[model samples]
Target: MKNYKLRRLSDQPILKTSDVKPSVDGFEVLGAFNPAACLVGDEVILLLRVAEAPRGKEGFILVPLIEEQNGTPELAIKEFNEPAAPYDPRVVTLNGKVYLTSLSHLRIARSRDGIQFTIDENPFLFPARMDESFGIEDARITFLEGKYWITYTAVSEHGPGVGLAITTDFKTVERIGMILPPPNKDVALFPQRINDKYMLLHRPMVSDIGKPSIWLAESEDGVHWGNHRFLFGGRGLADNPFAWEGAKIGAGPEPILTDEGWLLCYHGADPTHSYSLALALLDKNDPAKVLDRSDAPMLTPELLWEREGFFPNVVFSNGWIQWPDGRIWVYYGAADSGVGVAELVRE
Candidate 1:
């Protein structure tokens, strides 16, 4: 991190596998990662994605699957032999179908100092609607219209899509269901209305056969997304790319409105699956217009905790709180094993 300060890191993971309850009754907690963050008054609230699955046997790993019986979806457990399963610990492939090894749910964690956190033992969002039958993943929050609107990745057997929810008090939430259809995720709304319309930063897989890349879409009413435009493109087939962002890219913490423009921090993955943090600047009036983009990553997997864990070689930001002192507090997931914090100040 050349331009930022490594302010405070939690004594341990602010939240970890041990902190979350399994999504299914008989399952086990595998990891707690990629929290959606926002500051509520003096408290910082994080909607954490907790991954859980049934315990596996000696020669096989148990895969969680969603099945329908009598018009109702239920959790089904299946085992894929270690030698037959073609995936890292996170994703798995059986036959010709790709399946996530565990199901996920969104749980809340609150903190005052930004380093120490008290995570809710119960989930803030579970897989209820058919749209989120598999579960809910990373969420980004936007405070607008006097309420907190949450845009999250809703996963199911069909595919990963975007889901919305709103809350006045963190105690109760109203789910708006699927806003953007399947094959889209990593979505966050601009904190304020832009040019009298709502602008959102999202990463939709370019095509059925393409990799994930950042995109911008607008809405008159926040629910119906239209006017799709590609905002940022990652490396192409024959192009040389930055080592930290050559393979894929996605929207990260909610956009920060700076005097220069809208400061956006995002995550990019290299072909080796190394995930790093980067930033970009967009025109305030027209966010679809990119002003300046980072040539190199701001942060990479450096520390031992960042380089080793459930999924190694990753330092990904989920949410951030900008202090009035001109310092930005970033809460990120390290190797999907725990959470860490970083600070960015005027350079």
Candidate 2:
């Protein structure tokens, strides 16, 4: 495998939780990270997953939920003195019901230099349906035909599922509903169709039989997906519980097409759940055929911001932009709290 390096553009996080304001009135911004980036004309646009939670008080623990009133979404808080389950910062369980500690929604941020950005005050996309009662998160944007197809995770009481939305300009968006059902996320669609069929990479949660891994599927239309094939990770083929990707692996930024093949940047976590970025190349025609993969991660949590935050020791990317000059800009979430950018240099 060829050695590739990801050089950090800045020592500090480019966009932090404090950089973003909460969508709701009483809520506070807990995180502004995991952005899906693309170039609309000359400006780089980011669809960021903004996490919010109600203001903290002394005694009660607050769990935020999205409730609709007159067809408009509003914040609803559930206060609990004690959780039915053990204390977990990510989730709160009470009275046999589970709720997320923070609610997430997609917001827009625009940048002229791809480093510094000005975020939109209001949410670009929020919970509007029962399946997305929790929130929408981790969007991967793929421009197809004449419109951009956004594949994201819709969180609810059921589980995390893949949802789709379409937009030409960021001003207006059309929700296409859930594309892939619950227990699935980390979905990225290939920019162009392969073999006259649309393709995507997804990670489905597996516990009873196998471990979670990256899988490939095909569809005539981008909405309905099938032809499921295991590409990497899971029970066999190594990398599962290996050094860096010992715990699990998921699709990161949308696959980039190159002369050699399709370059895929993905994230893998060790047993400690420390996330890092890795690389893989797939056949130009047959994406399921892996050409070369990184023996180790090209980028890992080394910076202070990356090692500590809401959920520490993590660096994940769901969006990136490869400029016309062949310069690749990788925008990633650090410690699940802040957004950072790096340049991927191929030697």
Candidate 3:
């Protein structure tokens, strides 16, 4: 096995919330991060999860939500009275019901150098269905079968679920509805079929008996999934060397096919809820068999931008672009607020 290292580029956040304009009239762009990246011709494209919210008012807390009215999804703000104590700025318990502080939608960003990006004025994907009424977020893009397949989280009152969409041109996208049911998310589809079946990586939440972990599922038509199996999880508890992922782990960008195996980038959260990025390798023939994984996080929240903001101490990614020469450009969300990139190279 060869050693690898992640080098953070000089330009820390390639994109910021201020760079994006809100879709709603009175809403403001809070965060523009966690992009799904890809290459189209000579241009590098990003599908960014842009979170927006209305300004706070005195003695009241406002929650942005997507509501369906006359078969059209509109951005709506629900206000709650005073001292509505929040678990975090991202979430709040209002009248015994949980609500997100912001409503997220997918927006387009294009770049020629992969560092400087121009954000599109309008949204690419928004909360249209009831399942995505809360918001859609954290997309993973995989180019397969002559189209770009996007797997993202569809959040609603029920829970977060996996939703799929496809597009040939970024201008138009067709939703494939929800593939995985509630309490599941972080989905990434393999670029190609293995052993005559489509393979997908996802994370399922568990509360009572087990913790959230990465799992594998198989699909025959790329819509219906089955043959679910546990793929990876935290090594052990606090004393364990891999405890950085003790709280939970989820798949990041789509797996890259390498000579050694399938190179996968993933995020792991510790007990403190601090998130970091790690790498893993799966068997080329049998993806269910884990070949190797990182002992420690390759990318951690060290910089001030990564350590502070909305939902601090987090570095999460669902996107990366690989060159023919094996250089990988990893685009990550720093502090759930801005987008940053790092270079993954073999040492």
Candidate 4:
């Protein structure tokens, strides 16, 4: 980790909580983080996850929910006391039904240096489909065959599903609708196809019996996916506190294609929700076959930006960029409050 000079960019957080209410979603934006990074022409594009909550009575935690009423999706609010709400700040559950505490949308931010950014005033992608009634969260962007493809988390009453959008020029976007059924998120697509097939890394949240593990799926045309198989499992206890990734694990930025194999950086957490990142390699030809896995974390929550925020002890991302000289730039959302960048130099 020493050779990889991981410094917090001076511009620190390139995006933040917005006061503006979503045009048609929620009351006001609370936080923005977990950006999806990639390059477009000379500009570094960031699709930020902007989280918003309804402005309801302060004492009663208002859980905003959506229901398909009269053939149309409608927003509904459920008031609850602090103790009755779900233990997780991000979600609420009642009678075995789960709902999001906040609604999320994707806003655009761009920069040339990747440190200094210019964020768009309004969100570009919000809850448009019934599947995304709760809102859209973390997104993964891949530049495939001359177009930028976006696979993002579409959260709602049923569960979290994966949705697709494509754009040739950032100005126009084509929505492809929900691709994954439900109970899934944390998706990444390889920039180049494997064996002439579009390969994907995705995480599907499980019930009591399962751990948040990584899985692989293949598609012929970058849309339809099948032939699901297990890829990697999350860590838990180890001799050192920094070694365990037990809480849950998910795919981070899209995998980097290196001469060795497909280099994937993924996040793992402890039971306390302390998030850290690790590395893995997948066979270039058959991504389902894991070539190597990290015994220790490449990066963890150490700095204040990473250790504190709305969601403390978190450093999560959906994107990263590698330069020609083998220098890697990983931009992540710290504590779900703001954004930060880390640099990695290949030894």
Considering every candidate listed, which one attains the maximal lDDT?
A: 3
169-205: candidate 3 lDDT, tens digit per residue: 9999999999999999999999999999999999999
Could you estimate the TM-score for every candidate? 0.90, 0.95, 0.97, 0.89
Q: RMSDs, each prediction?
A: 2.7, 2.2, 1.4, 2.8
In terms of lDDT, model 3 sits at 0.91
Candidate 2: tens digits of C-alpha lDDT, residues 1-347: 46688899999999999999887888899888999999999999999999998898766788887778788766678888864556987787777888898989999999988988999999999888878989899999998888999999999989999999999999999999999999999999999999999999999999787778999999998899999999998222334435688678999978999998999999988877888898889999999999988887888999999999999999998988989899999999999899989999988
RMSD of 4: 2.8
Best by TM-score: 3
Output the TM-score of candidate 4.
0.89
Task: Rank candidates by TM-score, best first.
Answer: 3, 2, 1, 4
Better of 1 and 3 by lDDT: 3
Can you write out model 4's per-residue Cα lDDT over 213-300, one digit (the tens) per residue? 9999999988899989989897566555544587789998888887778888888988788887777888887888898877777777
Give the distance in Å from residue 268's predicted Cα in candidate 4 to where it truly belongs. Answer: 0.5
Worst-scoring 10-residue span by lDDT in model 2 = 234-243
**Residue 343 miss distance in model 4 (angstroms):** 0.8
- The lDDT of model 4 is 0.81
Candidate 1 vs 3: which has more TM-score? 3
